[model samples]
Target chain A: MPTMFEKIWNRHRVLEREDGQTLLYVDRHLLHDGTAPAFEMLRARGAKLRAPDRAFATPDHYMPTDTRRVAEIANPELREMVASLTRNAAQEGFTLFGLDDARQGIVHVVGPEQGISQPGMLIVCGDSHTSTHGALGALAFGIGMTEVAHVLATQCLWQRKPRAMRITLEGRLGPGVTAKDMILHIIARIGTAGATGHVIEYAGPAVRALSMEARLTLCNMSIEAGARAGMVAPDETTFAYLQGRPYAPADWDRAVEGWRALRSDDDAVFDAEVTLDAAEIAPTVTWGTSPQEAIAVDGLVPDPAAEPDAARRAELTAMLDYMALHPGQALEGLAVDRVFIGSCTNGRLEDLRAAAAIAQGRRVADGLRAWVVPGSAPVKRAAEEEGLHRIFLDAGFEWREAGCSMCLGTNGEIGAPGERIAATSNRNFRGRQGPGVRTHLMSPAMAAAAAVTGRITDIRTL
Target chain B: MERFRPVRSIAVPFARDNIDTDQILPARFLHLPRDADHGACLFRDLRGAPDFPLDRPQWQGARIALGGRNFACGSSRENAVWAMHGHGFRAVIAPSFGDIFAQNGLKNGLLPVRLPEATVAAMIARAEAEPSAELTVDLQAQQVIDADGVAHPFEIDPFARRCLLEGIDELAFTLSHEEEIAAFERRIGRENS
Candidate 1:
């Protein structure tokens, strides 16, 4: 009996390298502006890109679709990186989705929606969020720019086999309980470092009930748990999503056959197993320095003293200082200065709809700056067609263009020094948003409510 | 295939938890072309920051590093490892590592040691107190024998531990496993038929 990860990894295993590493032939390589400079070095060395068609590059990291100067950023270096990626992709004869091109969006979002991400494939990107592609039942993970260059030159990377783990959720989720909450609940159970060196395979009824969009949101946060990647097996739901997809086979018979074989056998073994009750999951929000420091929406701020571990105390204290939050304070009434609902993590149409619903008859609170940047042009168009943008804008939210805006502060969309924002972006580490800015992670809907009320308010109650 | 020379290097204080690749090399420098040899920029802003260890005067020029757990936490950019190696670090001593960064370190010949955080902290403190101190990191002995003869044992994955102890990087190790893998493949093929 074979697991999906095992099947994909085994199939991609080309030659074992001497160092106990498998020289895996990557099935797909997705590149963006921030990661292309390193590969551009290969051209400097006169080494041509080996597998042109197997690779793809796009300019999205620094693309600000809101501004007319999309091609030219204020930052000269970022501008060079975007231009270099566009040129390299062109010279290499690979698909280059430049700014102004409809395909120009987040690499992970663009890949799946464009039908480039397929099941049973091994995908690599230079972005940590590449794990988002595992929604297609692929083994995808982020690689470094050095490895990125090597991949462009050789179409392969040396990888060691990782242990497999399964996280099965039982029962049904309560109202407003989302895939974000599910993943957050799982992280809280496992801690930040729990999945340090494994590839997780999510299973069971709750996951099966999730749409492909929700599943992608779950896998996108695998990095927050310290996992190499996260995946879900394809079934009818997965095949149905891929039916008219640009890259999925058009023939229904072939799609059914492919989807049927995407599952793992019942007897397939996993290195570890964790079971969660879907009914127990609440609207989760994280506090402290790490994602694992999550608590229920109704829970109070964590007391580092209750942490028990000495090492955790110092870490918690550090976070307390950075965030300027005192111990034992309830997370509910904490005032937020900004709210950002964008990034590849939760910038889909469903995410926008969820946020828009909360903001429809509401307005952003005084002194709170709120913005909504869609993940892709298609997502933006779809949201606009549904008046989701109008709902957001009328609600005092600045509905903008598509890109990974306000995420990692790659573009100029960052927080003012010391200002705090409840962001839908994945990471909340100190200065992750800017030189001295703070980010509090939340669901897009939650972020919208936070923007409206200027505090951490439960979306369900709103 | 390579033209770099073996430069004798010393380890500075090790960065701990969530020491992202961006911190090692900021996102700003990421645009300088993949092979741009930006190792000099490793921990640039971090070192320049008033709070970073490198900003401290006493610990300057110390070789052999020690750190807390989860070093190099975020992205799997191999440039992070290369930047450290390029930054005159021969080895990094920590309790644990970001799994990807650890592999990247070994693949690129930046020796990563796994030790108790307390032991690593003690070593770092000792180096800070004595700038001329040299902590003899014997991979073969799996020990960081201090100048004062205080020895602390470290833990490592058996395979990665073996590779480093033998001073053999991943490439050499993969070459040695080729014969065994070929044999296993042949056996599996015959059995399947």
Candidate 2:
């Protein structure tokens, strides 16, 4: 018996090179503005996409989240980048969710939302977060522009088989602990590079019980753990989610029958295994520049002197200096200048509802800024229909349009230099949110709590 | 892409771990036109800070880079690799790399060498202390000759090694077997339809 990863990998193996690398066929190719360069590279080489129908492009990364006309874009480079993607998509004849498309969103979010990503399929994209698609039981991975060009030229990629690892979660999640917390806890236990060279299969009761959207959030950060991809078995939960998606098959019963066969064998073996008790997990937050530097929201900041690893101790010292913090200090009353509750990581409808629940009666603190950018237009429309936007607005939070806003510092939204932010997006690296801006990673509810209190407070305690 | 072979050049020591792609080339600069030279944007943010290692006069014109584990971590933007290559870096010696960055380097003719953690650390320290420090990385020999006359072995996928040595990009390599790929696509398309 083989693991689900192995089964999928074996099925997609197209050609085995003499040097041990295998050329795997790609079923779905997701593209974005970042892929514009690959398209240009292909054009320069006089190449054409092998199967344009299999490829989909969307202009999301560089697009502005604010309601701005094309003429109002201040950055000429951003305008050109967006224009280039539009030009290339039209030239290449690939389906694109342009700026006006209702489906427009982050590539990872749109892929699953529209059902372009399917169970038992191989998906590749130029963006690293493409692993989000693996929640549907697909073997999905990210590739660089060079590899993107290769895939476009020929719908196949040369890859070395990654080892298999299984992480099982038992027990049940406590109140205030979300899927984001589970992933943060995992990264904290196993440093950021813990699972390098392996594809992880999340099994056991805790994972199987997660909704498809939650599973997508878990798999979205697999790359942060240095894993090639993360996946969960496609069961009834997955089938139900995909049942009415736009790109999903019309024959729902037949589609489910195929998806049901995409699970790992009962006796499947993995190269490595880890088990975690979900009961002990708490609302988590990152205290340093790296994802692995996370601790419970109520936990004290680490004391560098207590660190045994000399290199890590120095790194921690530098991190503390950069974050303007000290050892043994609790993050509880740490003042925050801003709060952001969106990104592909936590911008889904459920995430919005969780934050809205906390903000229903509370108002954002004076002198603090907050923004909630939905994951996609559909997510935005759904949130508005449910009056999630009104709840946030009434609570003094600014509800913005959909895009990767404030998550990466590339867009118009940014934190001022030397300011601290409580963000629900992934990554807290130096200047990740903007130059000299410190970002603290948390869940949507935690970020909402921070917005209302103007500090990093435990959501459960709120 | 240029062909890879054995050569010796000055090495810039950036001992930091987890040097993510965002730091390599920030997203703010990613929107630059394709015609723009990526080397100009390499470490643009870090270069502005006075203490960044790349600002040291010692590393001026260095053709090789030395860093710790998980170098080029995060994001699949190939520009990270191109930025290094554009800045005259022919090879990056690290304990580990983000998978996509390493693959991107291979096709772009930038050699990514993975040596033991201890060996990489020692090499970086030596390179930093001696500005004129140079290393000869021989693909054929599968070893990097240190300034002190010690040869440190490194590992690379055999297929990638052959491609780099032959100056064969993935596009060229894949196109060589166009007939077979086309046949396979036709078969799959027919079955699915």
B53-117 per-residue lDDT for model 1 (tens digits): 76467656544456676777776667677677765566788877777788777656676778776
- Per-residue lDDT tens digits for candidate 2, residues A76-166, read 8777777788888888889999878889888888999999999999999988888889999999999988889889998999999999999
Cα lDDT tens digits, model 2, B1-193, are: 6789787988888888988888898877776655679998898878957668886887888888998899988888888887898888888999999888888898888899999999999998898788798899999788999998899888888878887888877778788988878777878777666
User: What's every prediction's RMSD, in angstroms?
Assistant: 4.3, 1.4
TM-score of chain B of 2: 0.93
Best by lDDT: 2
Candidate 1 on A1-462: residue-level lDDT in tens? Answer: 878789888877767645566777777899887866555556656666766877877777776656735445777776776777767776788888777777667887888888888787789998788889998899999876656776776667777788898999999888888888888889889966678788999999999999999999999989878888999998777777777876665566765776578678888999989999999987878776567777887788767888887666767877787788888887887898989898888989899998998998988999889999888888888999999988998989998877887877666667887888888888776667776676778788888889888999887787
What is the alpha-carbon lDDT for the whole of candidate 1? 0.76
Q: What pairs collide in candidate 2?
A: none
Against the correct fold, how does model 1 do in TM-score? 0.89
Which 10-residue span in candidate 1 chain A carries the lowest summed lDDT? A63-72
lDDT, model 2: 0.87
Which candidate comes out best when scored by TM-score?
A: 2
